[model samples]
Target chain A: MVNEVIDINEAVRAYIAQIEGLRAEIGRLDATIATLRQSLATLKSLKTLGEGKTVLVPVGSIAQVEMKVEKMDKVVVSVGQNISAELEYEEALKYIEDEIKKLLTFRLVLEQAIAELYAKIEDLIAEAQQTSEEEKAEEEENEEKAE
Target chain B: MELPPQIQAQLMQLQQLQQQLQMILMQKQSVETELKECKKALEELEKSSSDEVYKLVGGLFVKRKKEDVKKELEEKVETLELRVKTLEKQEEKLQSRLKELQEKIQKMIPTAQ
Candidate 1:
């Protein structure tokens, strides 16, 4: 009986560990989603700029240089694997939107998995408690008989 | 209660298994991320209407033929897919071993009233 309780406790620990891992994964996804949203907003605003407009383009993240917007309709977007594709403003917007959608769906799945694991942990704790209680009652009854 | 030496050994083994599993999982995640990027790039390449595409090479964007870039990305995706599968298999085996060791140790524990 004691062994069973110990095993249940161990199982609960494992479940909790898994939940922590999932939470970290979700945190990363959240950060990525935030970045994607910011990019989407920036792209939208950039699309509104008139042709030949002067804009300050950041150089090395610290200094910015005034640059002329040669073409407002086209932008180069990273397509992954270090490759960049020149895309129209509207196409780039759609790409970001699709990425955000995919990440949100993945986040939802992780959340659901965490919820299920929490339920399992609760059940395991209850089982351990009930087993311990039964053992205590049995000991008390035995003592009474002896008296 | 003192744990038997056998149970102690199993517990140590369980800990090792857990560490190995964690390492494998991290590796899988990184590879999966790369794979996702590769797939996305391929999709974008297919949809791209531009005549020129550039691949970043050591801090510089080197122009490459679209077909060549597509081929490279496709190969990378295939390799990553295989790697992820292998890591997944290792993860599954380690998990089952961990569970078995836990059960064995649990059985060895002396029952208390």
Candidate 2:
């Protein structure tokens, strides 16, 4: 009986450790989400900048040099593997929106996987508890018989 | 070990869950790091106002027009934003599930005196 309890205890400890690991992942994801949101906001602000507008551009360090935007309608967009193309402003925006949609789809798949894992964890915890309680009851019955 | 079949099955399930969780966490970490780098690069691009911008392609920086670079950065940022939202949703779902499991475990196990 003692050995059985110990075995269950060890399993419980392992389960808890895994749960903690998942928690740590969630924390990291939260931080990443914050950074991504900030980046999005910064990008949106760029839309307000007009063509031929004078702005301070940063060099290698913190220092900035004044520069003028020649054309805002056309932008060179990176397709992948170091290849880029000259595209109209609207076309470039559409390309990015499509990429975002793809990411959203990927994220949905990930979320589904996480949900499935959570369900499995719940089932395991419930099973462990049931096993533990049964063992406890058996132990009590054995003690009563001895008495 | 002479364990009941039910207990053995439960143990096996727990082990499987542990492995799955580890794999998922590894993937999550990689995605998070990639998003971080993308955000940093976008920030640097935003700070620079020069008409000429350099993009790193295949381990080499190629000079490109500033407008093009900005558009690329904006698209990257937007894509990352959607990704981050999805991650947040997953986090919330996991958190609630964890809480439920903890409560169930507490009920099953006797507290240490």
Candidate 3:
């Protein structure tokens, strides 16, 4: 009985530990969400890309569409802002998703273990009952032998 | 065993988050590339013309004397000045580009910073 109690305790401890890990993952995901929001704010500054007017390309004119690269710097800045903002959200979401996947996998294993544990408990109880019965039989045999 | 509906819902949510994050990352990468290109272009421009201002002031490095060295120099200076004007115009364009870039970045500053 003492050994059985110890087995249950160990299993319970393992389950609790797994739960703790999952909680930590949730916390991490929350932080990531905040970061994403901050990054989004920065992304707002980068809306100036591809806003240049396109010069008409004439078939016979030697004028190749000069990419009025004059505004390239502004475009770069706009895009960079977006990058910072967008990346934060991206990273946060990825992390959250990854944790969820791990959670799912871990939960599946834990559920299986819990089910198996119940079966083991039933088997243990049966064996315990049989042991008691065998002790009684031994006592009777001894008493008869003495008689 | 079948999983709980809540867990399934959570999984679906995670999928959405993953997709959103992927899209965000793509935007980030493209923006980063643009910044990098701009920096590269600026660096090249600086490298190609360190003495841009000096070049704009067309003059003889060595002093020479003639019947009218001053007038000749003045004529030469005027022609050189015209060329310098073109360079100045190009420089103006560069300055404008930088300004526009700054504006773009400024708008994004709220989210990026």
TM-score of each: 0.71, 0.47, 0.24
Candidate 1: the clashing residue pairs are none
True contacts kept of each: 0.93, 0.07, 0.00
DockQ of each: 0.65, 0.06, 0.01
Q: Quality of candidate 3's docking, in CAPRI categories? A: incorrect
How far out, in Å, is residue A144 in model 1? Answer: 1.8
**DockQ, cand. 2:** 0.06
Write the number of the candidate with greater DockQ, choosing between 2 and 3: 2
Error of 1 at A56 (Å): 3.2
| Candidate that scores best on DockQ | 1
Expressed as tens digits, the lDDT of each residue in B45-97 for candidate 2 is 55444466666766777888867776776687677667767766666666565
Q: What fraction of the true interface contacts does model 3 reproduce?
A: 0.00
Cα lDDT tens digits, model 1, B1-113, are 66767777888888999999999999999999999888878989887888779999999999888898888888989999999999999999999998888887777775411
Which candidate has the highest lDDT of all?
Answer: 1
Put down candidate 1 lDDT per residue, A1-147, tens digits, no spaces.
978977997899999999999999999999999999999987776667867878898899799999877776887888887899988888988988998999999999999999999999989888888888999999999999999
Model 1 DockQ vs. reference: 0.65
Instruction: Return whichever of 1 and 2 wins on DockQ.
Output: 1
Off by over 4 Å in 1: A60-62, B1-39, B74-113
